[model samples]
Target: MKKNLFLTAIIIIVSIGTTKANSFKNNIYQEIKKDSARLSELDKFWTELSRTVREGDFEGYQAAYHPDAVLVIKQNRSISITEALDNWKQGFIDTKLGKKNDKVEFRLSKRIGSKTTAFETGIFYFTSTDSHGNPTEDYIHFEMLLVKRNEKWYALMENQKSEATKEEWKALE
Candidate 1:
């Protein structure tokens, strides 16, 4: 009889612990859902910015960037938003690349804060043919640190052109 009572007590304690754990998990899940919704909104803004880039709409892309934004190209180099825009414009003009088969796709990896900040990564695929009709592909990996400013999320810092592969993409998921 004593052994049975002890077993019952153990079961009761385990059940209570599981209930508490499940309650904590539910709270976390709800928080994550809220963050996901906010991230989705930010993702749309990022998508628009990418489309502007693909179309070579320098003005539109410039407008999306925060005035004091910094873009860090690999190797720890950083440039201001205006400088980056100028460089992009010059490159487009020099190459005469008129937005041929340019596409950008983004996926939300992880959201850190309460919709005030997010870490996102994505892939950009751009294709253009040379004078001899040779196909060219530019596949780039990009990451951005976004902050909510004036009720709008703006990318404060951006990093691009990392060695992006299919495996890396999968790992982000």
Candidate 2:
């Protein structure tokens, strides 16, 4: 009878451990699934932003920013995104008219936030051609605060921090 009782206790302990392991795995899987969905949505946000730049869709570019958005330049000054956009409008027009071409690419160093908010740190490579077809390229480090509303992501604040070297840009994931 003692032997039988020992075997029963062992079985119960093993069963409890197995159950706990399965629960842990399920929790990990759920976390991964949630994070994957977040990344997918964020990718759509970046894709639309890049498309607007490449296609010279000024309105679409403006739409990517929240109405109350702010732009911080090199940690020195802050201004309304609307004012910044106005300054940039002529470049969009020039690109649309085929007088110039502009392109931007991002490489992230860090991205963190919840389902409705994100703070992204990245290096942006911006290239533009002059009317004479001469290309100018710059690598800039930037951080942006974004919020999702109604299933759409918009930039709430953009900080164009500083210039980065090509080596620095390539070091990020």
Candidate 3:
């Protein structure tokens, strides 16, 4: 009788342990699914922004950014909507003077964290026209820190315009 009771107790403990482990696994799976969904959504936004810039659709770019958007351009930084717009306009003028058009080719290098907050790094290739109407290209590595607020994701901070090589970008992967 004692042997049977001991065996039953061990079986009960093992069953409970298995149940808990399964529950934990299920929870982890759910979290992974949620993160994947969020990453897809973020990717969509990133693609749209890139398209807007490449097409020189300033309105579309403005719409994607928050009113209080902050942009860091080389050694200059803008911390307000008006300032950001002004900075863009200046850059646009310079690009036009060079007879160069802007194109952004971005490859998402990394995504870290969950839906509410994430760090994303990528490469941006800028193709434009020179003053002599010759084609020119530039490459920059960009990192954007994003935050979800009011059910929307906005870039809280960005580090961009750092010249990068293919090897450096590959290292990020």
lDDT of each: 0.71, 0.92, 0.74
> Which number leads on lDDT?
2
The RMSD of every model to the true structure, in order and in angstroms, is 4.9, 1.3, 3.4
Model 2: per-residue Cα lDDT at residue 67: 97
* Collision count of model 1: 0
lDDT of 2 by residue, 12-52 (tens): 99999999999999999998888789878988888888888
Pairs of residues at least 3 apart in sequence or in different chains that clash in candidate 3: 98-130, 98-131, 99-129, 100-128, 100-129, 101-129
Q: Name the runs in model 1 displaced over 4 angstroms.
A: 1-26, 90-101, 107-111, 129-134, 166-173
- Stretches > 4 Å off in candidate 2: none
Residue 70, candidate 2: Cα error in Å is 1.2
96-170: candidate 3 lDDT, tens digit per residue: 354456777677777896768888887877677656677767778777777888877777666675788867656
Candidate 2 Cα deviation (angstroms), residue 121: 1.0
